[model samples]
Target: MLSRTADHLYWMSRYTERAENTARMLNVSYETSMLPQSASAATKAWQSVLSISELLPAYYQRHDEVTLEGVLHFMVRDETNSSSIYSCLQAARENARAVRGALTTEAWETQNLTWLDMNRLFKAKKFETDPAKFFEWVKYRSHLSRGVALGTMLQDDAFRFLRLGTFIERADNTARLLDVRFHAIKNDYHGTVPGKGQAQFDFYHWSAILRSVSAFEVYRKVYRNVITPERVAEMLILRRDMPRSLHASMYEVVQILEAVANDHSAETQRQAGLLLAELQYGRIDELLATGLHAYLVHFLERVHALGGRIGSDFLATADM
Candidate 1:
């Protein structure tokens, strides 16, 4: 495959996944913000979304304060915010258009139609009236796009690259979401004792975290008990059986890197393998003992470094 084609295919998949993940993060914040909380608490929840995406500076430059209305508009429909859902879907469509030949007819149509439908929604100001419903639409469209690609596209390097992009984005988002939510939950209980109210508080926040990743039911089935922070972290960060878990994403990353290996991709493969090993053998107890926030920060740094390696090894032309 041409380097440019590969780049487009890879980024098309990433941007689509990014749109869905952004919706997921925002949805969690939206849901929690509806609950009874202090004004400062609510503001911090909204701010965490920006922090997770590394967009705080951009957000502050545009807005004087972190109001719910301002943050929602900035995240959902702001075209200038590159990480906004609008920009991500736009980028996804542009990349898909550039490599229509590499995509199946169904996949290309799905990508194009998603963009068109999103524009219509924006024109109708759908996000302003019902942001949750707007987010659900974005997630469903992303699901449809991935399903069509997997079902219609050939299982070749192009497909591998697409899958690769999806998992890489998933892994990073999962880690960020978990880290921020867990920290908030911890802070909420800083001076509280273990009691029924604390249990209820933990349940509400932890379940919100699970639902953000679409793993609430999975948590119920896998653990078959009350939701606890340790178990929640374990399920999201270590459990290989859970589809959106870090371990599972890394497993896919390792396998896909091996499948699409090139002469220059050895270092990329090795780094991916090392990351996978850390997840595969890692225990949640140890992670929480040391500090989940610190652990996740390190993991994000490694994921960023691995992304840089992938670009240098195979997607260098993306910069051009």
Candidate 2:
């Protein structure tokens, strides 16, 4: 296969995961932001999320209003927004098209249909009148796409690369979610409730996080208590068994990278191994000691930098 072919396959997987995770997160944040907020608090929450995703600057440049409508317009409807739902789905479909032969019919069809559905939704007024339903459709499609890929795709190099993309993307998103949750907890916990958000940590917010990975019931089974901010953040970020948790996703990514780069040079192996080591050995106690927000921000930076390194050495060839 050509380097470009592998690159496309890799990114096809990444973009699909990115689109799904983005929709899930935005849906949750949308609910959280809708809860009783001061005039500027919703904007502040959205800004924090956008900043964590590294999309705030792009959003600000394109939109004048920081209101819910303006930010959602930029993030949900704008074609120029790379991290937007539209752009991610479009990129995923393009890559899927480029490697149609390498992917199963189901994979291609799933992506293609989802893309079309999203386009239609954007054109319809339902998004304005029934925003919840619009987002629900996106989230539902994202889950369907993942299920088709998992059930129908082959488990070879292509599959491993695809898994690698999804795992890494999930880890990155988990970090972003944690950063937002931690900051919100810290800021709001002190206001009216001790160690809880000013407004009861909002069941809607926890449901959003749980719903992101479709793990709301799983959280209930594991914790068996009403969702609290600290536990939600912990479950989202630290739980090793949760598929969308940072630790689980990072572990999967490391294993897949090791499997794919089995013949890599010692230096490459050492770098990836070291990073994986840090992630595995980390203790939530230690992180909480230092502060979860600070740890997550730094951890995300490390993961992003590691992604750049992987691209340079393994995913893409360097000029000699």
Candidate 3:
């Protein structure tokens, strides 16, 4: 495949996954903000969403306060915010269009139509009145696009590139969500005993995290124990069976890289393999001993480095 085509295919998948993940983050924050909490706590919850999304710097430049209204607009519809759902969907559609011949008819149509529907909805200001519904629509469209590609596209280098993009984005988003939420909760409970109010707050907070990743039922089925920060981290970070787990994402990335290894350099494969190995063999106890926040920050840096290597090795072109 031409480098340009490969680049477009890879980024199209990444942008679609990013849109859905952004929705997931927003939905979790919105739901948690509705829970009983002090004003300061609520503000912290909203701020954490921006921090996890890595949008705080840009957000502060545009808005004076962290009001829900301002955050929602900045995250959902702000065209200037490159990582916003609106921008991601637009980028996805454009990338898909650039390589329409590489995509199945269903895949291309799904992406194109998603972009069109999003524009119409944004212009109608539907999200201002029903933010949850708007977010759900974004996730549904992303899933539909994925299903179309999987069900119709050929399992070839193009397909491998698409899968690579999806898993890489997924791994990054999962790590950020876990790290930010854990850090926030740890700060709130600074060695204090679980008072009735604190315990109640912790329960709801952890439940929101699980629901954000669609892992609440999986948590119940696998652990059958109370939700603690340690177990939640274990499930989301190390459990290979969990589809959105960091381990699973890394595993998928390595496997896809292997399939497409004929043309790429070995460094991309090595980075992915090392990360997957750590996730598979490393214990949660050891991770906590080193400080989970510190570990997660290191993991995120490695993931970002691997992504850059992949682009340089496989997708970078003179024109691009």
Candidate 4:
């Protein structure tokens, strides 16, 4: 496959996943921010979403008060925000157009229609009626696009690249959520500083975390109980059985990266191999023992660095 095609496929998948995770993140914040205990916490919760998308500073530079109105506007409607609903759909469409021959007619139509709907929804200002509904619609469309891609595309290098992008984005997003929750309200030996075991505490935040990943219902089904901090953390960050977990997503990313790089350059293979070893040998018990926040920040930073390595390894090319 052409490197350009591979790049498009990878980013197409990443942007779609980014859009979905962003929606879930905001949706959970909406639900959490309304709770009496969580009132006034929207800025912190939503700031992390912007941060994860690398848009925090940009948004702050342009405006003040990361309020629900400001952040939501940026996240949902800001064309400049690549992680916004509109930008992601536009990027997905551009990628679909780039690799038109590699995609099925159904796949192309689905992507195009998805983009059209997102554009129309943003234009209609229907998100004001009920932003939650609009975000849910975006998430559903993302799922539909994924389904069509999986159901229609061949299980070839292109597909592998798409899966690679998705799982990595998920892993990165999960790590960010964990970092925010563990750091934003953690109790500790430090003096009673701000955000130290606030009114909502980890318990309330756990629900937010669970909801952010769309794992609340599935988590309850699996564990069959109310949300717990440790269980939610373990399920999201460490559980191998759960597809959305950091561990599971990391596992998929490394595997798909390996598969995509296997027949290519030795450097790519070696990078993937190094990443795989980190995942395989790095024990979750060690992370849990170290305290979740400390471990998660380190893990997220490592993932970010790995993404840099990936870009340098196979995706980096100069414009002609």
Candidate 5:
């Protein structure tokens, strides 16, 4: 494939996945804020959403404070925010258009239609009163786009690139979510068992974290125990069975890269394999001992580095 086409295919999928995950983060924050928390707690939770999205700096540039309305507008509607859902979908659609022939008819139509519908929602200001519904719509459209591609597109290099984008984006998001919540609760739970109130507080926050990644039920089924910080981290970070887990995403990425391997893929493959093996063999206790925040920060850096290597190896071209 042409480097430009490969770049478009890869980024189109990444932006789509990013849009859905942004909605997931917003939904989690909105739901948690309604749980009768203190004003400071609510503000902190909202701020974490921006921080996890890596948009806190950009957000502060345009806004004075993190009000719910302001954050929602900045995250979902601000065209200037490149990582916003609006911008993600717009970029996805434009990339899809650029590589129109590389995509199946269903895939192209889904991308185009999602953009059109999003524009309508933006003009109608539908999210002002019904943000939850708006988030659901964004997630649903993303799912539709993915399903169309997986069900209709040929299982070739293009499909591999698409999957690579989805899983890389997912891995980064999952790591960020886990890291943010881990930091929030680290000091709260020293060595002592949490009191009843503290336990409930932990449960609520951890449950919200799992639900953000669609892992609440999986956590329940797999652990069948109370939601502790460590177990939540383990499930989201290391459990290969959990679809959105960091381990699962890295596993998929490694496999896809292997499938599409070329002479230039050695470094990308090596980095991906090392990351996946670390997650595959890692222990929750060891991770906690190492400082979960530090570990996660290192992981995020590695993921970012791997992304850059992949771009250089497979998608490097001036036109792209």
Candidate 6:
């Protein structure tokens, strides 16, 4: 494949995955804010959404404060925010267009139709009136796009690159979600134990966090108990069986990297392997003992660096 073609295919999938995950994150904040809480707590929930996206400073540059309406507009439609769902879908469409010959017809149409529908929603101001429905639409479209690609595309390097982009983006998003959600739960827990005053209050928040990643039911099945912070963290961070968990994402990433290995990708493969191994053997108790935030920050840095390495090796483009 041409370097430029590979880059477009890779980013096309990344942006689509990003659009879906952004919807997931925003849905969490939107739902959690409706729960009974102080005005400040509601504001903080919105702030956490921006923080997880690492767009907090960019957000403040365009707005005075983090209001629900402001965040919805900024994250859902702002063209200037390149990571917004609008921008992500737009970019995904453009990239898919650039490499249409490399994509199956269903894949291309899925990307194109998603962009068209999103524009209609923007014109109708659906996000303003019904953000949750709009978010579900985005997630549904993303699922369709992925399913189309997996079902129709040949299992070639193009497919491998596509999977690579999805898992890398997913791994990064899951880590960020875990870190931000963990801190929010910690603040609400206030060193309180389960079955106490704050327990019920914390339950809703914890449930929101799991639902953000679509892991709530998986948590129920795996633990078959009340949602505790420790177990939630364990399931999301370590459980390879949970589809959205860090370990599961990394598992896919490592396998994809090995499948698509090249002469230049050895270092990238080594780094990816090391990260996957850490998640593979890592324990929740040890992660908490050292500080989850610190560990996650380090993981983010390494993942970002790994992304750069993958770019240099395969895409021949800078990490976007």
Residues 141-220 of candidate 1: C-alpha lDDT, one tens digit per residue: 99999999989999999998899889989999998988877776677554474677767777888898899999999999
By lDDT, the better pick of 1 and 5 is: 5
Q: Which tens-of-lDDT digit does each residue in 208-299 have in candidate 5?
A: 99999999999999999888888998999999999999999999999999998989889889999999999999999999998889999999
- List, residue by residue over 97-173, the lDDT tens digit for candidate 6: 99999998889999999999999888998888899999999999999998999999999989988988998899899
lDDT per prediction? 0.88, 0.74, 0.90, 0.75, 0.89, 0.90
Question: What are the clash counts of all predictions, listed in order?
Answer: 0, 0, 0, 0, 0, 0
* Stronger candidate by lDDT (2 vs 6): 6
Error of 2 at 151 (Å): 2.2
Output the lDDT of residue 136, model 5.
95
Which 10 residues in a row give candidate 4 its minimum summed lDDT? Answer: 187-196
Better candidate by lDDT, 1 or 2: 1
- Model 5: C-alpha RMSD to truth? 2.0
Cα RMSD (angstroms) for every candidate in the order listed: 1.5, 3.0, 1.7, 3.5, 2.0, 1.5
lDDT of 2 at 143: 75
RMSD from true fold, candidate 2: 3.0
Writing each residue's lDDT as its tens digit, candidate 3 over 1-320 gives 77788899999999999999999889888877787667877888889999998889899999988988889899999999999999999999999999999999999999999999998998898888789999999999988998999999999999989998999999999999999989988887545535786677778889999998889999999999888988999999999999999999999999998888855568889888999999999999999998999989999999988888888888854122
TM-score to true structure, per model? 0.96, 0.88, 0.96, 0.87, 0.96, 0.97
Tens digits of lDDT, candidate 2, 118-184:
8777778667787667778877776777788789988777777777777777888878876875676
TM-score of 4: 0.87
- How far off is residue 156 in model 2, in Å? 0.9
- Model 1: residues >4 Å from true position, as ranges? 192-194, 317-320
